[model samples]
Target: MSTGYDYSWFILTQSIIKKEFALSGSEQNPDLTGKSWRMTLRRATNKGAPAPVEAFKSHGVDFIVRDRIEDLVAEMNKLAGNDLLKLEHIRMQIEARDREIVNPYVKDAQVMNIHNARRYIGDRLIRTAAPHRILDPAQGPLIAVKLNILTRKTLGGFETDLDSRVFGGEGSIIPGLYAVGEAAGFGGGGVHGYRSLEGTFLGGCLFSGRNAGRAAAKAVG
Candidate 1:
């Protein structure tokens, strides 16, 4: 949204890939093209992400809503000067979503400023704590983060032209042409700008596949 947050991952990885592989960044900065990271592939392409510090705002993302759910009720009841109970719950929610997807600011202790913990673990939710934030077994269940983490991955390994190619120009290929998902190459690989979708490779496949299918049918007929 804003801008100024400098992303090191994109800058570092790209540098390594090119310095070692002799590969090009897009086509323009074929030289320092190594300065971008796979993660920034989206923002670098998006009309938004101008800089990092400015783009990285608050922590807005999807997470588990924790009210209280435990797999072991009995285990939760057995702890008392003894190691018996082990029940837990985890969930939290936030107002920002889109911003979190691209640039998520990981909080410390992960406990937000509201005394409540927010999680972006695949889904959003309120991970509640014990009364007065005691974190006691008797007070309530302890909400924790799920194993699966939710994050926005960048697009790369392929190159897409944005100049004469037009935005999403390859969206629909002509008959006889076939596209192989990411197999194509750097998407929106231009000197100045690019556009990219999250994980909708099927769109590209369908467009190219359809063209091939039609071409095959005509040849057979």
Candidate 2:
């Protein structure tokens, strides 16, 4: 399943990895699941991400850690079994992005998005890192991850009537049976268009579930 956020080009620094990368899953985040604000605050301001993130960096096959970009690209190419990425090309992009931060009115969209996200007090304090050059050594060793595509949403499934009654093979409603969420195509799959934004599947799932629940309750009454 997709993690819902794209980190394909995300370059993590050794110093910020702990604070920047929070591994997915409930068990990976004791601070959050346990509702310990004090621990959470520590993680936010801390130099490291969570323990699980560190473990992945140390042992995960997809992770490439290097002191230099050239070496990093070499490892990446080796891992991918091809020389598709060029060191110079990647460096140029990093340099160009780094130059944008010098001006407050930079035209870079991604940088602008980061700035906008950090405008909120909460994001500024705990989420968004202060803008910095990627090549800066003070941030520590650079890290690249070979992100893999994950399948999550099922675009279409069993057909259903407006009330979420499942349609049988002969185009008839199956009595006392219903479907919802992804099974019902997320409210006929119209809540989100052809392409959905990151982390938006939940909205469709919740909406369809609510509709099915209401319909089932009404039928019973």
Candidate 3:
């Protein structure tokens, strides 16, 4: 989802139309068969990753390391249990993206964005990595991580007022019931609308909790 392309990692999604993996079973007993994403990064890039090198190796089934692109592709395909990705296609894409890194005034949107982000002191020092060719032998020992899509949070919940009181079926306040934070739909059900901004949920949660606590204290007093 992040398109900043800071050259930290190369993300590739499986062809949705070309494949139809199983998705049967209940939420608690759900099946996760044949679902994976290919995320490749060079040795230098991996060093900058939040997790340490040992963590990736310990990640069983989801982690892969290879010194060569050809071998990397082969392992990736073997992991997927099918020939979903072609070595040539993957090589060409990486090569094209790498070519844009050499040009300071490159027209590539992703590369340009990465450059722009690196302009910030904080990003340059920690978050963003300097542009580099992903396939460069100097940055050898390519790493591939098989990622899975999972829901971490919900953006929708019960409609509530400023005081965090839940609304009844007829839109009136329901006494003795207060839904705050995410339960009250993240900032009283209207602050974020349909799509909420990332990293802003904590503020919403605190605000809603403060209001709910204050209102509850007043009601009891």
Q: List the residue pairs that clash in candidate 2.
A: 18-48, 18-49, 19-48, 19-49
Cα deviation at 74, candidate 2, in Å, is 0.8
Q: Would you give me the overall lDDT of model 1? A: 0.30
Ranked by lDDT, the better of candidates 1 and 2 is 2
The Cα error of candidate 3 at residue 23, in Å, is 28
lDDT for every model?
A: 0.30, 0.77, 0.63
Give the per-residue lDDT digits (tens) of candidate 1, residues 1-221.
13432211110112111111221124333223556554334433332222331122112121121234443233223322244323331211221321332233535333343233224321122122111332223322222221223333334433323211212446643433333334443232221125554334446545544554565666668
Instruction: For residues 24-116, write the lDDT of model 2, one tens digit per residue.
Output: 567888777889998788876666666688789989999988999889888888987878788999999888877996678898788898889
Q: After superposition, how far is residue 110 of candidate 3 from its true place, in Å?
A: 2.1
> Between candidates 1 and 2, which one is better according to TM-score?
2
Question: TM-score for every candidate vs. truth?
Answer: 0.24, 0.73, 0.65
**What's the best-to-worst order under TM-score?**
2, 3, 1
**What would you estimate as the lDDT of candidate 2?**
0.77
Which structure among the candidates has the greatest lDDT? 2
What does candidate 3's lDDT look like per residue over 1-221, in tens digits?
37432222233211110011112222211111222122222222334232233444446576666768888889887877778778999899888888998887799888899889889875664446567777776654566666665655667788888788899999999998998887877742257655676666778888888989999999999
Most TM-score-accurate candidate: 2
